[model samples]
Target: RVGLVEWEAERHLLMLDIHHIVTDGMSMSIFVEELLRLYNGETLEPLRIQYKEFAAWQQSEPVKERLKRQEAYWLDVLEGELPTLELPTDFVRPAARSFEGDVLPFSIDKQMTDSLQRIADENGATLYMVLLAAYSILLSKYSGQEDFIVGMPVSGRTHADLEPLIGMFVNTLAIRHYPSGEKAFLAYLNEVKETMLGAYDHQDYPFEELVKKLQAPRDQSRNPVFDVMFALETKEDNVQSFGDIKIESYPETHTVSQFDLTLVISLLDEGMNGQFEYATKLFTRNLIDNFAQDLLVIITQICEQPSVLLKDISLNGQSEQEQDVLEAIDIIF
Candidate 1:
């Protein structure tokens, strides 16, 4: 019955220690919600399956076969492709190792989210595709490369058996989008939808194994493959309470990873929330924040004027901070 408690710090940070056997990201959310109820003197329904059951189920035969086939697909599709995007840099790029940094988060409004969803539905695509396409375009503009690569995480739970059992089942799929001159939004959306569907169709492959199969040249100079990753997580079952104790989540500071950079955007009924986690050694917090703001502006502009030229779109509403960041990258590399 390890529960929440406060840590001593100038700023607020909540701490908790749940045995690894009992919790994961998904379960932690639920545990928090339960804690809240209990602290307010309420009870909760018992969980259907303990964590070990889920872990054991994940090792079953069907899961293995699915993973094998997915690996084959990834090996074939990703073969011979340059694993990394050549991002323009102002300084000499650092070694291949990932660095730690901070996360800058922000959100979109409900009206915008609704509009984006409606457009996605009408276009016979998904909100995810729309976001991916926009990100591709942005990468192309920033890198001066027409073909852009981005890594996205998929739930990778195609079968009913795997849905209830979660153990790092998320697969990172590499999407390569090559934008042609003056392509229409619907056309781009169609391409993105197809790419996403194909990736989903073969997403059981573990990302680490796929990278090995691709023989992606390890570059101590930069990230091995893609420079950016996008993740969308919308659901969390969280409750917090314990006896007469109430619990609330204070913001937590996240250490950045070694990967080039990752922008995780989540959509809720209310709006969209974005978190930019980058290598502190590679980029300053201000640079990452500017990129997030610029991305929001780009998405908004595309929603209003999807037909705008790619170059024009990238250069739109360029703030001094963003320009400086871009220029710095350009000068460094």
Candidate 2:
């Protein structure tokens, strides 16, 4: 999926599509680092272990007990008939799901970013925790269910041995939160904080093993367990030069994803950027646009009144016609 957009035959946008199968988020950084080192003709030490060796060792007998405890924890946390959110879609959903999608890019102004950070600092939590709690609130508004699950990607590089290896060391963990209608948004952050800590502690459980341990009912039209995802992309301070031609980061052109909807918060030098990637077969651009705007509004609302109950928060107002369409599918917002 590589292409070139000609601009008067002087400049062009070079696009390259690297599938997640070949690598993941963290691997891309390592790939560029090694590529630069090789391009500079630097003498490097011999490799000690390859990705295949790491994979084989992961399934060895030494970590079975540790993995078993994680398996039990995940099984207990994710036990229930996972609710499939009835999101508003423009087109009819096909029996089989496709990866067709687009990314809606937005930015958080400096003021908003600063306010969010203040909220995080006051609550003794990271911005990621604040963002996840805000997203959970938005999801609860969209889907009328009080309890739901969201899947978040975790960097599964637990040991230093796998840091330099360009491989699939990323894993997805299901974070289930039961939003109490009476609790304040700040109180809810504590719940998200706890969930994040527990998930990281048990991250040694292989995702494939977790899937096998709890064989949930299969749904070809949607992904297993959870369909929504939230991730924060932190800026990496890597400057590599290949002779005189130094490599610079470019805006992402690939937007398609396997999930129903994914919200990626990119922390940039100027401000924070938000990208909403949703399945075109199951969601429309307008619907995703409303969601993106509503999420920002929710963040503002929470920052203003951290003590407000989760149920009392007001989402951005949508048109009556849009409201009707969403309600037709049981969506509240």
Candidate 3:
């Protein structure tokens, strides 16, 4: 048994404990709704197929051929000396990394969220693109590297049958973003949008299949290829109720960091809610909180003036690159 919840309300107010192994974000929602409906004595349609069938079919011949087309694209995207995010850890990492994690929650005000949405719409991009750009900007600033990779989870329900059934119908994809040219936040948004579009177009390739194909250099101290994950969750995760007993779900973060860190951002009526999951082995709450605040600042400023140089977004004044660029400009002038 991976997890259990003490249902004795006297001892423990309404709570849930589930192992990450059995369910993902999407699957948990399905499980809850189904349980409620079943308790209310409502008959439901029979499941077309279960997880076992889906797993078996994934290994079939035709699917393998289809996935081949994606191999070349993933390989090219991940090419070069793929380095991990250069986040400074508090201590030297052990030979084998631990999975302890912590979750820091924060919210972006409605005005900033709306501004970002407008920017996204104006640019023919989704809010995901806008948020991702801002996130990439933060990573860029922290690591001081124009190019790096971040993982994003995709609902692997490419087939219609897999949608209604509750299972691990999700896959994690690595997005390797390369900041181009003058590195204005606006242009970076466009770059991220394009990458997102490509990822969607090629979403059918199973993540494991892609990772196996890439053969990324392994580092036991961290995850292969990418060490950070970013997810943008939507309305599907809203609070559910069966007439008065409202049950709201919040992300559960712990002492382990899965792949250096995982950032989960959810869209809410008030604004965007962000949960930063970091490894306890490498960071503290204060540091993660500061990073989260900085991200909000970045998002706020970028939407207000998208054309601003990436260097200008720096919290500690101009970055080294910004100074170098200024020096060149001064010499030329």
Find the candidate with the highest lDDT and give its number: 2
- Deviation in Å, model 2, residue 296 alpha carbon: 0.8
How would you encode candidate 3's per-residue C-alpha lDDT over 118-156 as one tens digit per residue? 998888999888888888888877777888899998988
TM-score of each: 0.77, 0.86, 0.86
Is 1 or 2 the stronger prediction by TM-score?
2
Candidate 1 lDDT by residue in tens digits, 83-134: 3566554345665465766788888788777777877898888888888787
Clashes of 3: 7
What is the per-residue lDDT of model 2 for residues 164-207, given as tens digits with 9 covering 90 to 100?
88788888888887776678888899889998899999987877
Which has the higher lDDT value, candidate number 1 or candidate number 2?
A: 2
Weakest lDDT window of 10 consecutive positions for candidate 3: 4-13
Instruction: In angstroms, give how far residue 22 of model 1 lies from its true place.
Output: 9.1
Candidate 2 TM-score versus the reference:
0.86
The list of candidate 3 runs beyond 4 A from truth reads: 1-22, 235-239, 244-253, 316-333
Q: Which predicted model would earn the best TM-score?
A: 3
What lDDT score belongs to each candidate, Candidate 1 first? Answer: 0.69, 0.81, 0.79
Arrange candidates, best lDDT first: 2, 3, 1
Query: Residue 134 CA error for candidate 2 (Å)?
Result: 0.5
